[model samples]
Target chain A: MATLSLRDVRKSFAATQVLHGIELEVADGELVVIVGASGCGKSTLLRIVAGLETATSGQVVINNRDVTELEPADRDIAMVFQNYALYPHMSVFGNMAYGLKIRGMDKAEIERRVKAAAEILGIGPLLERKPKQLSGGQRQRVAMGRAIVREPALFLFDEPLSNLDAKLRVQMRAEIRRLQRRLGVTSLFVTHDQVEAMTLGDRLVVMNAGRAAQVAPPMEIFERPADTYVAGFIGSPAMNFIPAVLEDGGASAKLEDGSSIRFADGPRPGPAGRRLTLGLRPEHVEPTNGDGSIPLTVELIEPLGSETVVHGRAAGGMPIVTRLQGAFSGQSLSVHLSPKHLHVFDAETGRRLDS
Target chain B: MSSTALPAAVPMQAERDDALLRATRRRRVMSKIVAHGALILGVLIVAFPIWMTLVGSTHDAATIGRGDVPLLPGSHAIENYATAWNEGGGKSRTTPAALMLWNSLLMALLIAVGKITISILSAYAVVFFRFPLRMAAFWAIFITLMLPVEVRIIPTFQVIVDLSLGNTWAGLIIPLIASATATLLFRQFFLTIPDEFVEAAKIDGAGPLRFLKDVVLPLSLTNIAAMFVILFIYGWNQYLWPLLIINDRSMETIVVGLSKMIGSGDSQNEWNTIMATAVLALLPPVLVVALMQRWFVRGLTETEK
Candidate 1:
């Protein structure tokens, strides 16, 4: 187990900069997941930590040692690639024992480690089978067994479960979590899947455009996102942003359609008449029959088994989606945006504003 | 009403399906007959000359010299083969068939192995490394594919003479071992190996040579086997170059020595012994192909990667 510190990490390719000074600290035995959309440089960050790619400028410290100049092998880290990258010609046991053999480990020790890892992965009977003969899930287990046998200081996973089917992906995701916990290895997992990040990581680093937009526990990121990007990205059906302006000494927000909603938490620390963007999650919007409810012209309805997601537009052509508890067959309905769960952000900067 | 109608339609549908199945089976049997006929005719056409040589090798020298080549084996088979194996066939009778056969086998093996090793290494360097003038090096090798041995025969001979390699095995093999075609084939095969394998090898602490031995070499076994068969046949059939290089009768390959065994309008020539030597020269290449036929087909059709 080891702590990883990426200090002022910046990367640039030719003239276009990709990563713009990312700083993160991963504690020992913590599985920190770097989650983002494609082209957000989440994989690039993981590769940098793996020493597969050198940062344009920064320091990568693993267990208080500078590893920026070290080769991937010398850095004592193992990576599970997206495609599994198992040696097609070698048997499962050979694949797992290759690294230790290269290090001049004794034959008996290599066998013992490979056998133990195979037992952990429940692939003991498949030790002599080639990669092509194994199913996709079995190959994934072999890939993890290869990493586990190394017992490296850190584990780097580059979308390891992305190639599996949906069911297998979920199953392997849970298995990876359990295995990592048992091994207590410091790992940096990179993926474009927010659900994988939420379910797998001890802490999530929500990356946006090569920068860590928010770094916190999954629920913290879901409950109180650092910015509009993280707020919209983390939750399902995404948080909706309604253009509004502060009113009554920042005690309430007046939306564009001349509707005002008072803040239940308290008055935010902003000047009156300041432009503000009110954030409301889909699940937070309640279908109400009371006063002060905004009418949403229902455009589409998706009837999921447990809940229904209603897509509609509010006044002034602002699109809003609300998740209702049960099926509702209606042309239009009124939704009350609860002040208790409203996310306040500055219209100019997308940064969350505190009340 | 629908159930009553279905009973009447079922018999008619079954009759039509049965007729269709019979027609398909008839066509399949007719096509099989035609295919086997064509294959047998083609095999006979190709094997006729070899059959003639085999039959002629079993006859007495007088039978072949008189232009009465036997269609069936004669009682002189054992004697003719013994004479060919022990005594040389030409008028000088200096180089024995045993020595010539050994020379040819060694040369073919050397050339095949040398070509494969050099081509695989060069192709690996060209495909994997980021050296200066890398593409220039590859193109230069590719350009040599257009230049056959006949095209540069004079200069190549001069180089062999100046290096004092004439009459030596090096003169016969070295000039022919640098194969551009084999290099290109290997380069194409290496390109299909995914980048992830290299990365995984790197993470496993394997350097370039280790990776080549552990991963690249094993994956390339089929291709190597295929190339070996082709190069062995090409080496075994080398006539012009071996003729020009070897002045010593002891250094003569089977192909070169077999041609020398024939005399122009000489009634006293040992035609039976010459035919036996000819049959011996064809054996090694056929054996190589037969042994590696499975790998040869798989190498061309399927990629392990």
Candidate 2:
């Protein structure tokens, strides 16, 4: 196990800068997932840490050793690729033992490690089968076994489960978590799947446009996102943003329909009349018929077995989606945006504002 | 009531379906007959010459010289083959058919193996390495495809002579070994290998040479087998170049030797021994193609990667 520190990491290609000074610290035995949308450079960051790609400027320290100039082989890391990257001609045992053989390890030791890893992965009977003969999930297990046998200082996973079907993806994701926990290896996982990140990582690094928008535990990122991007990205149906202005000495926000809702928390530290964007998650919006509730003209309704999702527009044509616990058949309803779950952000900058 | 009604309606529909199925089966059988007929006709068309050569090889020289080539094997088969294998057939009878066959076999084996080795390495370098003028080097090799041996025969002959390789095995094999077609084929195959394999190999601590030996070579076995068959045939059938270069009777190849066995006056030629030698020359290439037939088809049609 080892700590990884990417200090002031920056990358540029030709004239376009892809990564603009990313700084991160991954503690030993911590599975830090770098999650983002496609083209956000999450894979690039993982490749840099794997020593597959060199950082244009900065230092990559693994276990307190600067290894920026080292080759991927000398860096002592293992990577599980998205496509499994198993040698098609070799058997499962050969695939797992390749790295050990390359390092000049004894034949008996290689066999022992491969056998142990195969046993742990529950693929003992498939040791002699080529990759083409195995199913997709079995191939994924072999890929993981290849990495496990190396016992490297760090493990790099580049969306290893992305090629599997949805059910297998979920199953393998948990297996990977359990295996990593048992091995106690420091790992950096990169993916464009927020759900995978949320369910698999000890801590999540939400990347936006090559920058770490927020770095925290999954629930913390869901509960208190650092910016509007993270807030909208993490939650299902996404958090809704209603354009408003700070009013009543920053104690309340006045919507465009001339309706005002006081903050349940303390007043935000902003001047009166300041433009603010109020964030409300779909699950947090309650359907109410009481006073001060905004009227919603329902446009669509999706009935998912245990819950219903209502899509509608509020006054001033602001689109809003709310998740209700039970089925509701209505052409129109009123939704109360709770102050306790509101996310306050500055309109000028998408940064979150604290009360 | 519904079950009783269903049986009554089912007979009419079932009869119609049965008629349709019979018609479909009739058409399929008719098509199979036509296909088999065409295939048999094609086989006869292609196999007639080889059959004629085989039948003629079993007859005495007097029967062939009189233009009465036998349709059936005669009792002289053993004698004709023994004469062809032991004694040379020509004006002076200096070079034995066995020696010519041995020379041709060596040349074909050398050329096929040398071409495959050089082309695979060149293709690997062109596809995997980032060197200066890599594309330029590839295009240079590709450009040679247009220049067949006949096109540059004079200059190539002069170079071989200048290098003092004339009438030598090197002169016969080296000029023909640098194959542009095989190199291009291998380059295309290598391009389909995903980048992830390279990255995984790197992470596994395999250097470039190790990666080539462990991964690239094993993956390329089918292509190599396929190329060996084609290159072997190409080398075996070489007539004009071998004739133009080798003046020594000892270095004469089977193709050139077989052609020389025929005289301008038909009566002076030993047609039985010549036919037996002709049959001998066709054996090695046929054996190679037969042995590697599976890999040859798979290499051309399917990609294991």
Candidate 3:
């Protein structure tokens, strides 16, 4: 019954509408991640779901019951914020038990639950410490512990790992995913980092500006982007876009410097003769001394040890990045783009074209 | 800026570099010294009057007037203090000055608590919630910051009179309950409170009042304590309003009553006792402020951050 659904959710601050109509659902024990850049209204959407903000015109149902107008306190949910937002004056124990104490929980019960949560978060030794005394990671753990003690129906995380350093963020991200899985709680995590959303979410929701670009499993989102924006945003190095024209029953991409690239797969009707946007993931394209390969002169080679990222441009100034395997160090390497991984988009609307 | 711009700008303006560098450096150093000197001078100007009150408290009236009286402690401080306390009030019945002291303390406490309660809650309402006329009410209250309390004194006085609080503690406390400055200060500090914190509390399922008490109140200790100190000092040191309102010497606050004693020194006022009572009059605020200074500056600075 703790499953939630948002129907036609919208928000506007005066003249500016920050969130368009957003429809989403979360079944019991599901983990959903909403990913978008800053000011894209991803955080606002999460805030609305958490009952911290009211949607301008929408129905938010929790457990199939309309909880749209309910006070946040009565909504039966818990949230962890990006900044942790720990009560500075309170010790860790006090912070964890504050909500229960307000709900008239028995003193011993509050203590026991707080202690248990502290143990779960590995903050038992630091319960007496204030937030100021703890490190960033510890503070994050305390924030989680405070949420855990509430034992609410759903958990809301608003970029909770964003404040941590890279190493800590990675480690905490895994820990949070593991914890969420173990607790089997319905959770909605909001983050601008697509990598985080892809890895941590049971279902990844890619948001662009204010709308959901695509919603799918990680592999599906990465492999089959719903649109040009989703293709560009979901991947780390981003999909390269090359302007193309369909000719002789095939697609041909024209580079700015007048060089042309031909894909082995023939072009379809709607996208032929018109300007076509060609998409290639960095990993799918490669350096080759073979035929049907796009020639590229490497301008820079970023050797990331495991996978080298080759940055180069075609004769037409269409910049491209090729993800290569091990030790390819040079500034003039040529890449062979695989037609199998190529994505076609209609140039007019940036929508992905089906093969 | 790009690295090329520096060399381009530097060489093309060769004539501008003539005395510009030296003059600017010299001006920087001169202004630095003057700034520090002014700061020290300003502190001295503020502290000297309080210091004088303390020194005057330790001596008889004639010694105080000697002008060359040493800054060090005098021998008769204890006796002078006792005399100031004993004769500072009235002719026997309940030693009305004690009653005055009690009355002033009660009024100040009531006013301080009332002003703080109304102001902090109002600020919270404006900051973290949304309703019709929210911004309108905020702007209306904010416009008061531009209008000095001095400008509204006549109307405020009339309002106090109409409420039948004339010459009473209620008269003193009521007009001071909703201070524009306190609300403004509280609003500033409250704005620094992150909305994320409120959301976190909300998702924890906390009601508005509970959120305020359990979350907002705890986070706001330093600010509230600092604001409390400031408002208390204002209430304690109030003079002109009390003088105009309270004709009863027995009900007069220390400032008003002290003014009366100084002005009506018809029997060669006991300078020793006057100085001592003056010292007593200043102690509470001075001690409270000194103790709370750390929190005050911290709160003020955080308001901007």
Query: Quality of candidate 1's docking, in CAPRI categories?
Result: medium
The sequence of per-residue lDDT tens digits that candidate 1 reaches over residues B17-105 is 99999999999999999999999999999998899889888998889888796788788888878888888785667488899989999
Residue ranges of candidate 3 with Cα displaced over 4 Å: A248-274, B1-83, B89-97, B142-151, B262-267, B290-305
B1-305, model 2: which lDDT tens digit per residue?
Answer: 99899998999999999999999999999999999999999999999889988988899888988888677878888888888888876555647889999999999999999999999999999999999999999999999999888999999999999999989988989999999999999999899888999999999999999999999988888888988999999999999889988999899999999998887774468888898989998899999889899766876565566
The best candidate in terms of DockQ = 2
Candidate 1 Cα errors over 4 Å, as ranges: A268-274, B1-33, B264-269, B295-305
Candidate 3 lDDT, A42-134, residue by residue in tens: 998988887778899888888888889998878888889889888777788888887787778999999999999888888899999988889
Pairs of residues clashing in candidate 2:
none
Worst 10 residues of 2 chain B by lDDT: B295-304
lDDT of 3 by residue, B1-305 (tens): 78978888887688588679889999999999999999999999998877776776676666765655557667788777666565572222122345556666777777788988998899989998889999998888889888776788899899988887888877877777877788888888789888777766666556789878877776677777877887888888787788777887668787777666654434455555666677777777778788788767776565421
Global fold similarity of model 2 (TM-score): 0.93
What is the per-residue lDDT of model 2 for residues A254-322, given as tens digits with 9 covering 90 to 100? 999998988888898777899998999999889998989989999999999789999999878999999
Error of 1 at A129 (Å): 2.7
Candidate achieving the largest TM-score: 2
Q: How well is candidate 1 docked (DockQ)?
A: 0.65
